[model samples]
Target: MSLKPNIVLVAALALSVAGCGKKEVDTLPPAPGPAPIQSQNQGSQTRIVPGSQADFSNRMAGLDTIYFDTDQFDIDDEDAVALRRQAEWLRQYPAKRARIEGYTDERGTREYNLALGERRATAARNYLVSLGIAENRLTVISYGKERPAVLDSTEAAWARNRRAVTLTID
Candidate 1:
C-alpha cells in the first residue's frame, strides 16, 4: 500500500476522534443589576454594584475567610456557621459570582500543599453549593504555600495562613 492512502486514513481517524466528546453546558438567565445602597455620606444614596468585589467584601466582612487545622481540609462547626452566612449572602445577590482561594501553611512541600489547598477550596465551594448557592457562580484556585497570609513562622501565623478566602468577582 502507498503512504498516501495511509495518510488519508490517519487524517480521517484523527478528525473523527477530535469530535467524539461534546459537552452540554448549562445556561443561566440574565443577572439583575445591583441593588442601590443607602449611605449617610452627604445625605445622598450610593451604590456598591452587586457582584463586584467591593460589594462582596462589604457584605461578607469577617465571614470571608475560613481557617483549617494543621494537615486537614475538613470544615469544622465554626467554619460551617461562617459558610452558612456566606451562602446566605450569595443567595441575596443571585447575580454575583465568587472565587474561593485556598492557601496552606509554610510547612509542606509545594506539590503537597497545592493539593491540600485545592481540597480546602473545593470543600468551601461544595459547602456553599449545599447551602443553595449556584454551583456555576463559584470558582476555585489554590495558592498552596506560595501565598501565606502571614510571613511569620509562629503557630498563630500558620493558623491564619491555612485558610480559604472567598472573594466576589464580576
Candidate 2:
C-alpha cells in the first residue's frame, strides 16, 4: 500500500518537473522589422549600354546611327529615321527608361567638350521627344573627352568618340 502511494507521488513530481522545463517558442517579433530601401542609382541592377552586339540585337535590332559633321548637334534627315525607330521602341516599352550619354573628341578644352557633349545628348533627346517620347523618361549626361569609344588620336577615332550612346535602365 505504501509503495503504491510513493509511486504515485514520484510520477506526479516527474510530471511537474517536465512541465517547468518547457517554454513556448516566440515567432512574431522579428517579422515586423523594417526593410532597407534601395537607392535608384544602385549599379548592380542598372541596364548595360546598348552598343554591344547582344544588347543592340535584343533592343535596337536593325536601328543604327547616322554620323554627324564635326561640332554639330543638329539631327539631319539621315539621323531622323534612327531616332524615330528609338522612339517607337520607347513607345512599345513604356516602363523602360534611357540615359543619353554624350561624348566628344579630344579637340577642345575640357569645359568646351563638356558643353558640346551636352548639346549633342540634348539634341538627340529632343529629337526623341519630338517623336513622342516623354522627356521625363530620358536622362542626359556628358562624358566630354573623358571616355572614348576609340582611344587612338586619329580622325576615325575622333569620329567614333564624338557620338551619343543610349543605355536602357529598368
Candidate 3:
C-alpha cells in the first residue's frame, strides 16, 4: 500500500469523527403570552382569556363571568349557582387564580358607582374565599359605571351592566 493513500484515508476518518462530536442544539422555547384582563379592582381564577394555559383551560371550562341584578352587590340564588361552579373548578385546580371585576349601570354618580363596583367585586371574591378558594389566589377590581356591559339607559341594559366578571389569570 502507498503511504500517501494511508495518510489520506486517516485524515478523512479523523475529519468524519470530529463532525460526530458536534451536537445539534434545540431552538429556544416560546415566549409567554400577555397578562390577563383584570378589572379596575386592583387587589385580585384560572378561567382565562389569552393568559396561561391553566387559565385558558378554566375559561374554556365555563368559569367566565357571573352576573347580578341592578344595584345589587349581593350574590343572589341564581348567581350563587354560577359561583358554585367557579368554586368547584378552583378547588379542582389549586394553582389557578382569578380576578373579580365589579361593574355597575350608568344610573349612579361616577364616584358612587365606582364604590358600588368595588363592593360587588369584593362580594364575589369573599364568596369565593368562603367556598374554600384561597383568598390569596383572588383579586378584586371595580370598573363601576366606567365599563358597563350595556351602554343604553333601559332597564335591561342597566341590568346587564350590574355584574361581576371573573377572569382567570396566571
For lDDT, the strongest prediction is 1
Question: Model 1: what TM-score?
Answer: 0.71
8-110: candidate 3 lDDT, tens digit per residue: 9999999999888766668877797665543233354323333454444455464456676766788887777778887877776688888888999898799
**What is candidate 2's lDDT per residue for 58-149, written digit by digit as tens?**
56654534355689888888678877877877887787787888889989899999999999889999999988899999999999899988
- Estimate, for each residue in 110-161, the C-alpha lDDT of model 1 and write its tens digit: 9999999999999999999999998999999999999888899999999999
* Candidate topping TM-score: 1
TM-score of 3: 0.64
**Residue 86's C-alpha lDDT in candidate 2?**
77
> What does candidate 2 score on TM?
0.64
Model 2: lDDT of residue 112: 96
Candidate 2 clashing pairs?
none
- Candidates ranked by TM-score, best first? 1, 2, 3
* Alpha carbon lDDT at 56, candidate 1: 64
Compare candidates 1 and 2 on lDDT and give the better one. 1
On TM-score, the stronger of 1 and 3 is 1
